[model samples]
Target: MGRHRVAIVVLSGTFVLDLAVAAQAFGRRPSVFAKIRHEPETPYDIVLCGPTAAPTSLGFTIGDLSPVEWIADADTVVVPGLEEPWAPQDPTLLSAVAKAAEAGARLVSLCAGVFVLGQAGVLDGRRVTTHWALADEFRAAFPRAHLMEDEMYVDDGQILSSGGMLAAADLCLYVLRQDHGQAYANDVSRVLISPPHRAGGQAQYAKATTRPLSGSLSPVMHWLIENIAEPLTLQQVAARANMSPRTLERRFRTETGDSVAGWIARRRVERARELLENSNLTVTQVAYAAGFGSTQSLRRHFVSRIGVSPRDYRDTFRSTPEQSRTVGRPQQGPAGTPACDAGPDARRPGPFSFMH
Candidate 1:
């Protein structure tokens, strides 16, 4: 297969990290896998599409960038988060983005970039996500788009959207996995020192709960997390919470947006990840410690919920002293700017924002 063309549509007021993260993920050659003969080389040809002069959020300018016309040949069209995502974008740029989508290019947005897609009418009736802080505004702005309030990312086949700035990396890794295989994606993830595959449904990395649980279910939720190691059934949970099994199931759905079993499984997987990152325990030991009955059970849940097996997760996240220092070094881009998926700044983005 030939290289797929990926055009990152960079408008004025683009978020610096959003543009750089996609560039780093899809633009770089898999140089680490050169020695492996069987690996696929269907690398992406990343084209930056923007105005003659692209203004960025970090007080820098991207000059001599390609025009919106370049999107005509793209297999995928990505819009990075804009500092002004809720404002109106240039009509010419919106037209180009819409045309590309209508021509069968896969559409992707990072953070508030979903606003651009919504403006272009590409996100209508599609499942999507944006920064958690902007969820209320996005829902009001594009009522046709089903915004997943807490998801890290949403993959609606051709149309993809991710939550917040850091979630851009998560979306990029997912696209890489879809184009290549899991092993290839994992290898590239190791090179970038990031998780290859975080589940799209995982909650956003936000501040502590300003919004409390809907009702008296807080005690049950806390107890579940505390006793995750025990093989507690729904009936058992209901008994402890002083409610019937049916009531417990309904309340769990209302308060947590998931089933009783699913919430427990996700929590256990999180516990396993914590142990893997912080302890020197064996995989079997970690499995038992996190509530899985056996190593096999741990592997199954870990792969399903966390996107990697126990050993591999530990290998990437729990590196030795020396390896840890070198693992997270940023890859160099065209100039001196470090190629990394950096997080957003502390300032809250404006509502109904759009790129210029």
Candidate 2:
């Protein structure tokens, strides 16, 4: 495929991290890193630009950022979030974005960048999302938009929008998956060391309170991952962390942005996804492997969380010979039946009960 041109439009007051996420995901030097025998080449030709080449609010300036109107040739145009999204935007910048969309460029918004797209009239009558904290404001500002509050990202074919700051990476990864397929997307994700995929349906806010975790809980978290299939309880988890169950719950919530049970379920589903894609295991076998206990339970959670059934997901993302090396850290178990490392898909657990 020919290299697709990507123009990332940086507005004044831009959150620097938003721009970097898209750049890193799309600007990956795959040739230097991917040892996979038949890996696909990187597909994007990325450019950074702004309305007038002004420095951002954070004081970092991109000397090479072109003018916003240069986006005319772009196949994809990204708008990064701004600190003061409600402030007046430049008419020229908004017009350029609207023009690009009218010419059929795929439009994307990161976090609060949805405001720019909204002003361009690009999001009218389209399903979209932004940071959860600003969902109400976004709804009020763009009444025509079909705003979904809990989504990680929404892909409405020609337009895509992501929730919050970090989800821009997820959106960029989605672009890769759409362009290059899941294995290639996963390959880029591993390079970035970010979570490979978060289904658009995932809640924007985790169940935990807003506070960040205080101390290191890696030891307990690692142990829990290693022993996911065991029939562990709150007491056991607390004991492993050397804390009382109540304290453990508080700390775990703070540390991971999720409750212990919620985290385990998400991990189990990720394991199921891996097995479905990489292994020829039956859906029933995969259920047991991922600690879902029964195929019925697997189907319920898999569909609810992933927006697809196990069978459908496997069929869509199943590893082919060319894709084998890119999916995960391949390993050999026993007589070399193709075991995976502790990558997302290979962390299958035995029968275990959820501690409510």
Candidate 3:
């Protein structure tokens, strides 16, 4: 297959790191399996395109920029933040983005760049995320869009939206890992001086939980996070929240955009990730502790939900310094938590959570 042609569409006064992150991820060479990936000499063709005058930045002005045609012919298109998101964007720019989406290109937006995607109406009926500070604005601007303010990035199928600058880096690393493999992406992370792995639910800059003036679902959600080990049937949760099970489900979906079962699994995964990241839990222990019935069940859910194995998940998001540099790291969590899928299966994204 041909190399994935990546395009980064630049605009006036774009965030510096947003462009830099994509360039670094796509432009750099890989150490492992280089020969297999490239036939001696081939690299990703990263084109920075702009339709108007070179967007000015700190000390550097983008020039020789390609147009949206690059996006049309590309596999992935990244849209960086503009100088002012509150103002209207150029209609031409929005049109180009829409075309790329229709063409089935994986669309990505960094920081406030999600606004551009929203302005184009491409995020309609889609779940998206942006920086927490501007999340309220994003919600107000796009009522139809399911705006996720808590995540570092919302991987809503083909289109992705990141929470902040570092989250952009994390997202790029994630894409790299998905495209190549864990080993190759680890090398890139090493070069970037960042952790080789970051669990997706590690919360974007820890949520600031202020006192709720009223009884919002935030308290119930907070309680759920702390008590994952307790009996948590849907009706039990509804009773605790003082609402009907259906109302509870609706509120939970609105708050987190996931079904009750899905949210529970995600939280279990998040908790499992935390144990994997922070503890020395075996796969069996981790699985049981994360509320997964068995190791195989954990592996199945982990891979399907989080896209990595339990050991691999532990290695990526383990809270402590791992002694083993192997691709998959073994772990055991706090007592009573059985490790899930402790066998040869390496696709288990055990359990993990850091929403606190």
lDDT of each: 0.78, 0.77, 0.72
For model 2, the stretches where C-alpha displacement exceeds 4 angstroms are 28-32, 36-41, 199-356
The count of backbone overlaps in candidate 3 is 36
Locate the minimum summed-lDDT window of 10 residues in model 2: 204-213
lDDT of candidate 3 at residue 213, scale 0 to 100: 24
Q: How many residue pairs clash in each candidate?
A: 8, 1, 36
Residue-level lDDT for 35 in candidate 2: 66
TM-score of each predicted structure versus truth: 0.60, 0.57, 0.56
Q: For residue 146, what is the lDDT in candidate 3?
A: 93
Candidates by lDDT, descending order: 1, 2, 3
Q: Compared with the true structure, what per-residue lDDT tens digits does model 1 show for residues 59-140?
A: 8899888988888668999999998788998888888888888899999999989999999988888999998888778999
lDDT of 3 at 320: 54
For model 3, how big is the CA root-mean-square deviation? 8.7
Model 3: weakest 10-residue lDDT segment is 347-356
- TM-score, cand. 2 vs. native: 0.57
Query: Which whole-number lDDT from 0 to 100 does residue 264 have in model 2?
Result: 77
Candidate 2 lDDT:
0.77
Error of 3 at 202 (Å): 6.7
Better of 1 and 2 by lDDT: 1
